[model samples]
Target: MTGSTVGSATAARGLRWLGRWLLRAKCWLALLLLTAVTVWWLSQELILVAVVVAVGVSPGLVGATWVAASPRSFERLAAGPWRRLRWRRVITSRWEAVCRDAHLAERRRVERRSLTGERMITESWRCPRLARVRTTSHAMELIIRARSGQTVTELEAGAERIGSIFDAVAVRCWPVSGSTVAIELIMRDVLITPTIGTEPDGLVVDTVRLGRTQAGRDWLLPITGRHTLCVGASGSGKGSVLWGICCGLAPAVHADLVRLWGVDLKAGVELATGRHLFSAFARTADEAVRVLATLAEVTEQRGQAMAGRTRQHRPAPSDPLHVLVIDELAALTAYAPAEVKKEADRLLARILTQGRALGVVVVAFVQDPRKEIVGMRGLFTQTVALRLRSGEETSMVLGDGMAKLAPAHRISPATPGVGWLVEDTGSTDRVRADYWSDDQIRQVATRFRTGVQAVLITPTEPVDRQRERSRRVRTPKAGAA
Candidate 1:
């Protein structure tokens, strides 16, 4: 096995970089074309008049298209026995999107979408295109009112899905009610990540048996601090999962590369136990505030240092150090004052946004996931949700993508020492990681612990940013131009 040629294997794992770049380029081009068309159409005085007249003559006949020339036309399209029959032939036409929803801001009350609908065309349109091709537009809409004390973020999140897939539905929540969201896009964007150690349990540790035979099967796959999300309710082995990550990452400390920083908000009670492995930790909101303020300074210093470096080795992935881990990140938000918490969130966001290339990999754990905790759950390259109260919570934590990632594995504080590890497969393939004990955790921590190495936290991880963007912009290799 040691002599095995792993070049192709490893390269295959990383092919997503190219695929993503192509995809992203395609999206950028598509967006540009749309904008240009919109501008050109709007710029033409006569064309604008014609379009307005087109809309006025018959709303049903109007062909309202996006500036980007996307195939979104409000035409008088319809499906009947003949059209439906024809559609069956093109039924398998690929439709996809890489959907991303960021938490713009939280809303007070969330409205419940009214659950009512029938498959009768309330309206229709026929799209006029090359060869006079015609396609009809269908409407699917539902409305939900917000309750007095419900949160708006939850409602919109639910509504976004409703409008996109179930029905063109809207759920209004409290505060600024009556807002509507349309789900017209489907997810085509796929996130691909290199699968680091295939050894079972390598993605996570703590449960790796202490023997060569069964233990090798439990190799802890390091998430590369690439991006990890640890989820577990109050009692559900949140600490245990952290132990697993720590143990898996232990091999990196000696590289004079890996640097571990933690935000343990159990006032250092739960997370403090790992202090031997952690370089520094923020135990309270005040400590966190100070940590981030210092980190901001650190960022500038590293940026300067990186900027002055020679160009020959510019952006070498190995030049910058490796590793940045955050434990109990949400606690920083839950405990800090609004002003400080905002800054804290900003710092964490910065890490997630740009911590990759400086050889900085991030892993953050949170018990309860709110929109504000990490904004969009999809951002995390990999997720290790130990267990939560409900499937809704899990869906919110892992995105609907994890709908079939095994039934919501409920974990209570009593069972807090175990968790279910979910890696981003890009497609279908499921794996699981088991629970470990404190003593087992300590043993690995002791073995992996090494002397301190100052982490020069750079502001920009250029290589990471580029590679990540590429993965996000992948295009089909099946000969897509």
Candidate 2:
């Protein structure tokens, strides 16, 4: 009985070695080398005693230093052939359990391994289905591939979904490849996106809630980055989206850090409304240009100052600043001279590219982002598609190819505010835009009514906030007066 027991133990040990070698060969090799070195050092006795002690204490000391540490224990498994067979059996057994006793199902003929290097190409058929929620569409893709092994695969794992340019998708590389693998999956019908916010209720607006309501798992807003473009026809809710963003910006801006430069060509004071805080509002195209130029100057100065700072060592701005909100850009564009427009575009370009680090943010709203308005090459990469008055206008703001949405989402004169947003992130999600009454705008601006900055007012305001700068200028220097 003792000899039999010894033989069983020896077999078990051999199997363990085999499993380790086949599954974790690199780890086992390092473990064996370490064991050999320790054994050799121990043989040195008193001469290497300190070295042995040092080695023995190192792991414990390092582990105690940081609570979140990687474990070195898993590196010590032994290796060999029989262990691989044992592990294979364990895996096979578990896999078989899921299929056992049901039906013989799809049993395959047992065969020897015959694969060398192999590759597979896959394709998926897409179908449009009504979205499960309030979204536009729920997309589904069915994919099939050619391969040789009887392995498991996941739906999203073997598919590639590229967004940004919509109504069409190009298949990039699939995540997984195998022979005879087939899968059917439904892709979500997406949108241009709606501005998002958290409501007191736990319910999330729009189509995708993921698994919960509220911002919960559904909040797709990315915290980093600067710049966004909003466009749509009259009543598409482009104004509504801007309103929600302004509402969100209120708490952020009132935190009393950054500056908001608003340019509204409609000559409306709707957006300038707000609390007792730091802010600036521009009513004309020339005024908008001046404000944007000031931002460019700040950007150049900051970049020069931070040239020596590394990413980890970099410091935030002395103030919290982000999210520029410009309403009715088309109107402003109409008034600026071609040269001034070019200069303003250049400054806006810089803001979109480098403003994130310096705490500068931009959220520009235009009725139609036709290639003509922002230029084919412009700063508005992140766009929100609101309702459009014409199919051509929708195509212009959303890309000529997106013309399909024209007949589908066109806006009427009464929409006032409503549309979808395409955030700075590449995803083209759509949501319902929020809004504010004309009264809300006036209320918000009451506090900022203090007046304009001297630099801004010199060219645009009838009077500057600092009475001394303008009060004395118009009065003529003391000698002139």
Candidate 3:
């Protein structure tokens, strides 16, 4: 049995090699024949004919070698036409029916004032014009012009209806204009179930790529001069966002331009997995209070140092940027003992309100983003709301009236990493957090771990004591006087 298995495997490999060699040979032969014919017709000089043939055959040989080197690229190029054919068929066959069933056609009656001020009633009939349907490797986009008197809110609200009509994995709506909406139908749920690739590279001190949007745009979080809050339900992929930020800043961490401080009150279950990447991490409420205190002290020291000297703080190795990442913020804010909670709140408020300009940032994750839970929610300049339990929860995390439009509460559990990001500009985007598995985190942590740990200056330090001692030493020359 072993011999037979080995024989079959050898045969398959040999066949593959022979087939590749034959393809290269065929290309060479065809190019040689064409070159020979052209040379024969162009000139009778044997030397000129030889030169032309040599140049032509050389190009064919190079081309064949490159083609053999990367077979996957050639296979993808070959399959492009068939993929487009199927995409066109899907669009032509089902678009109209799906739109109609999703209630995109206006069928009701509405009243309008006439030019002469007489009221007139007319059929409120206007169908959504199917402008274009484009298909890509990841998703299909349906651009439609909303009919008269229709708004993007109505179209966005109908996203699930349209998704159900077409049996898509999910649907997202982007309002291109007042009367134009671009609906995206995700054919497959690839965002939540990504195959691990090369570890994500890090960014400069102040930027972090949270993840990519459903349309494949990088969703960057500018942690410079801004605070961020991430809220999601359990198992909704909030951890992915945390690790995404870590991976995006790993290079800076290694360079000592960034110092990461973590407060994982869950006994270090979620964040301790990447223990090597953090400069300082706290696993208990008392330790968390101390961590925040150190950050608050750092913020104060920088503020005094920059007082009246500079308007904005610049990051440097002398004062590396400090980022305090807290998992389950409610544990520190609402669930801790009264003493620890009070101090934690004060330290956190100090950091959020005054730390950004000093290069001290915070990225806090919570399962619920109620004001009662994180009372200083307004202090955060950026917020990302993932899958939630209710519309009110979404609204609370994002803002009022966002629940109906973005509808984060309605996000499917199967698409775990999907969420909505609200920046300081008040613009909202639907994004998916990158899936970072345990193995990927370990690999990145091991690669970027530095031996140097960050040093924090407290309010009381030996430098001040040294200054006082120098003053005394200079004054004690009474004998010489």
Candidate 4:
């Protein structure tokens, strides 16, 4: 090669090396500055250096002590910020790879000309930009601006992959705006520990404190004018949620501000223990239909009375809020005899449709959330989904697209009460209901029993047998004579 060509090649190589070095100059500069500062500090007098070191280290030592003593306080004050900074760096550094792997990045091809005038095509990936990172005690919230051709649904679909890459327990994504999405990385499972339910000191008619949310806030379920549907697989703590509501409304039940009507189709085994807390208890399909019919009638009566007077029903001593608790809704709606099922469905549809405004609400629990089983599932204003069997069931219970965001099916079987709460507004929250033991349920039932008891109307004996018995009693038996 000619000397001019050789010189050009060497210069090209040197420029490439310098370009690579400049890319990492910030890190190298920071390291060098830190080292220089350390050396200069060590060169000072021993006592002065010691004082400086102590002053610098004291905050860390105190912070460690605070973490050990009061982790909650430390988390709010110092640990949260530290985690935000650390996780922000980690997530930003891995953003490209994660997005690419999850198919959330758009690939572009660009044509460029080489130094020799040759054409070349290169591939480049454009990923969603991380706008912000916020840390909570057990989670990290990421706000990301979507790249071209990216949608919130894409982010939601890749939430599981993103969570796995970040070693998070779970990830939830929601749209913040037209071009922005917010993702929450659950770093820890806060619902592993069971929360204990306590009886309210005074009457609580508006809302019931059922358990604790993933964010460490009290999970208050609104009860006054809302219906709730609890769906979960067998052994998924459906009873815990049922009893949590009962326990929370104990004081109100005793004060006559609320009345519970329980229907336990499994031979009353589920709700029989808390019979005292219920004004009406049904163990048979026929009895359940009767109770539902009664509730429907009451709802209609209340509606007529308040048709023009008021739009809302307020609980009073004379007119209490009627809560119909159905332990196994499928038994009444899906598995019952044709006649019984038709009547039960008709009555339940009436109550669920019109009862909210009349102070009559239903809290139904079922293992299966299929539309065929509970056709009126959408009527409930609030829904709680525990460890469901599959994503399909989660979607059925909450709504479409909720399976990706809530993922109740992914909940550990060991954590029975852990689930996701979906409000009517389409917002979802991770929550766990307090486990109410049999002893606790009995205590609450006995302590909060209303003075009135339910009078169940059941089937009677045949008229022929009754007449025979009456004839025998009237004619005096031969042996007695």
Candidate 5:
């Protein structure tokens, strides 16, 4: 309140305001200074000509320099930063309007009394604040601080409109904190290019490299103590996921650290090609049931063996991890006879529930994800949802309301193997499995054969011979005729 104190405080406030103003106007000040220098230099014709030539050749010179130097350094130090700054400016310029258009802006009516003691009514709009913007090679991430009355649901509902306005291929929003949300705008389709399956370095039993995530990170599927259920429509690259896991496990199988059992209920049309890789292969309904029962029994025995000894099962040559891969799970769970279906469901339920800690894991692939068909779907810890028929199916596979976040239903049919991976913690990521051709499968299987031939339980008689016998029994003898 003293005169000198007030003067000092006023001066401090003035200095702070001037600093902020200068910071805001720095770019324009730089441009003005550059223009003034250019005008002064252009008074000389030679200097003007040199400036023009330099402007014309600078791009090529920079390009050559980048090529000569480290390209990655240039990208990280120069190009990436510039792109991020430019996108930040662009997004900031349109943030308010975008929020208003998307219905994320809250409006309120304010009543106040002015200095004249008169009542005044005013309307105000509150838009969500853009906290930060980060850019990658193929995507933009926007971190938003929600306004007082805003909810994450409102933000999620407006994601599509935001993506369309920003010319993004897709948009996903997730809550980062109680009042903050992160939105990812996918600018390009990174998963469009299919990649071939690659063998892992050694016996990697915990997680296997499947393919690349949408962010171009390695997509590793955890198989050691996880039961994975992959649900996709027919021709939606279910085979790619199946073979990707098998290929990654090839080394482990060869080293006797992992054992693979295949149950292809499509009459061996799928698993027969890679039979050498499996310790036991089942094709018919009866065979598949027996295989499930056997695995279930093994799981029980392992659980009893490791009950008090150890809490977790460790993979070794003597006690290897058992991976049972079932193709077309609906065949045994839904479409089989009553006896087979009941027995298979019971056995699968037991295995899926108890096998995770016992070193017995099941990777089942199915087209239908209906609860009635795969009632034990909830038991699987990891769910991979490929191109599905509807949002309903996506929710069924990945839990409720995940369709909006992951949107496996929106995956294009042209891009097989592209799907959403839902982990047990309720986080979702978009991933693509590496494609494995028949030739590649055969090659990998041959190179890493377990040398433990499967016990194939085929029919007793050939179909043609059985048909001939039936025909002769129905027909009269030649002499009687």
Candidate 6:
């Protein structure tokens, strides 16, 4: 029995190794055959045809063979060039068909004699010029220059029509320059499924992997010098984003290297599942306001302490990093009572403007992101918009120009956790937040419960009321009658 098990294991390993080698050898084999054919054609004394073909295919052949031993490396190296070559053919064929079918092609002019005996011909219309083709990791970008009499607006309006002809997942168009336009057809959907990853150790101070981009790149959110705002409708996966942040910071919470204050105005039901992971938690409007005021005071104290000695603050247990996570921000900012709303606004504004320098940051989630509703929206530089109702709302969360580029509104309802992240640099990427099962959340909360040294802040109550509650708790109940 032992010999049989060993033989089976050995056979599996051999098959995997063989598969890897074959994947590498296929690209090399194609290059070798092309090289041999070019040499044969050149040896047959066909000068012009052989010269043109050899010059085009030889450089690629050399590069592929150099990386032939590593299958993954070869795939990465070949992907860009192969896509560029393939897209050129696809564009030339499909674009012409589209132009003809749509009656967008220019007609040739013929000379005609006028009644006054002078020959005249009308000017012919010009076709859109293909400026260049750029291949990204998962999509192809076409840069086009408009003709003399044509406008980029016409091309932008027809982007969807062209996309339908190409069978693309999504089509995006924008002006690159005054006279040029860029049309990108995303051929792949990297975020169609929920990506699974383990909880972060939180030893690293400022980095966390939130999800992945449409290009299969890790979307790392940096919290040291930034604040994040996530906007998504109900059932649009806001919970996933919130818990992803907590899970990534759980280890730091356990170590006391970081402190968390949670304000879930939804009666603490959303964040209560991971209650053990936070230092202080607030459920009501009053409690949330109190927590914000305390955080603002702490920021002020930290700033005063750093005034004389240092200009920058470093995070540690003595003066740990502070993170304020608020779910349903509109309840505090827009829907609270008049007095509580005013106080909440005053305290939150103070924290948002002056907290980053003192190692204090906020991550807030909201359903509506209108400027009037979230008056302090300008303070958050990192914004994530997920599955919004319309393009207007998408622009409200991600910015005006991002509505068409990122297309958060077009996100299918079937895909809940997928969203687009807009950076401070005005670049946009589609990200799918990691989903945590109930069991996984419980496991993380139990494994990384806050320690004894953690300080918790709550709204102060009257001494008599607290004594009465304690007496009631200590009083024993009578036997059943």
Per-residue lDDT of candidate 1, residues 392-442 (tens digit): 777776667554443345443443343444433322122234455556655
Please give, for residues 1-481, the per-residue lDDT of candidate 6 as tens digits: 6988866665665456555555767776576567667777667655654665666555545554444444466557765567667877788766656654534456669898899999999756456777887766667777877767667777776677766777777666668877788777777787887866576765756877778767566778887767889998888888888888888888888888788889998889888998888888889888887788788878888999999998767888777888899999999999999888888898888899999888899999999999888999989868899999889989888887878878888888888779987655445667888888777887898998877333435534436679999999988889834
CA RMSD (A), model 2: 21.9
lDDT of 2 by residue, 254-325 (tens): 444334566665674655454232355566777777777777666666667667763311222244454566
TM per candidate: 0.44, 0.48, 0.64, 0.69, 0.72, 0.63
Q: What is the Cα-based TM-score of model 2?
A: 0.48
Which scores better on TM-score, 2 or 6? 6
Q: Model 4: how far is 393 from its true place, Å?
A: 3.0
Pairs of residues at least 3 apart in sequence or in different chains that clash in candidate 4? none
What's the lDDT for all of these models? 0.46, 0.46, 0.78, 0.83, 0.83, 0.78
Candidate 3: list runs displaced more than 4 Å. 1-75, 78-134, 142-168, 175-182, 210-212, 216-219, 304-314, 401-432, 437-439, 456-481
Model 6 misplacement above 4 A: 1-137, 140-185, 452-481
Off by over 4 Å in 5: 1-82, 92-131, 148-161, 390-392, 400-407, 423-428, 451-481
Model 5 lDDT tens row, 1-481? 9988876765665455445545666675576567656766768565765565566445545644553445577668776677677777888998888888888887789999999999999998899888988888777888888888777777767777888888887666677887887888877778999998875667788899889888767898899889999999988999999998988999999988899999998889988888888999888889887787778777878988998899899999989999999999999899999978887887788888889999999999999999888989889988899999999999999888988878999999999999997654445779899998899999988999996554543223335679999998999877894
lDDT (Cα, 0-100) at 475 in candidate 3:
85
Q: Of models 1 and 6, which has the larger lDDT?
A: 6
lDDT of 4 by residue, 230-334 (tens): 999899999988998888888888988899999999999989888899999889999897788778778878999999899999999788999999998999999
Ranking by TM-score: 5, 4, 3, 6, 2, 1
Worst 10 residues of 5 by lDDT: 453-462
Which candidate, 1 or 4, would have the higher lDDT against the true structure?
4
Can you give the lDDT of residue 167 in candidate 4? 91
Task: Compute the lDDT for candidate 1.
Answer: 0.46
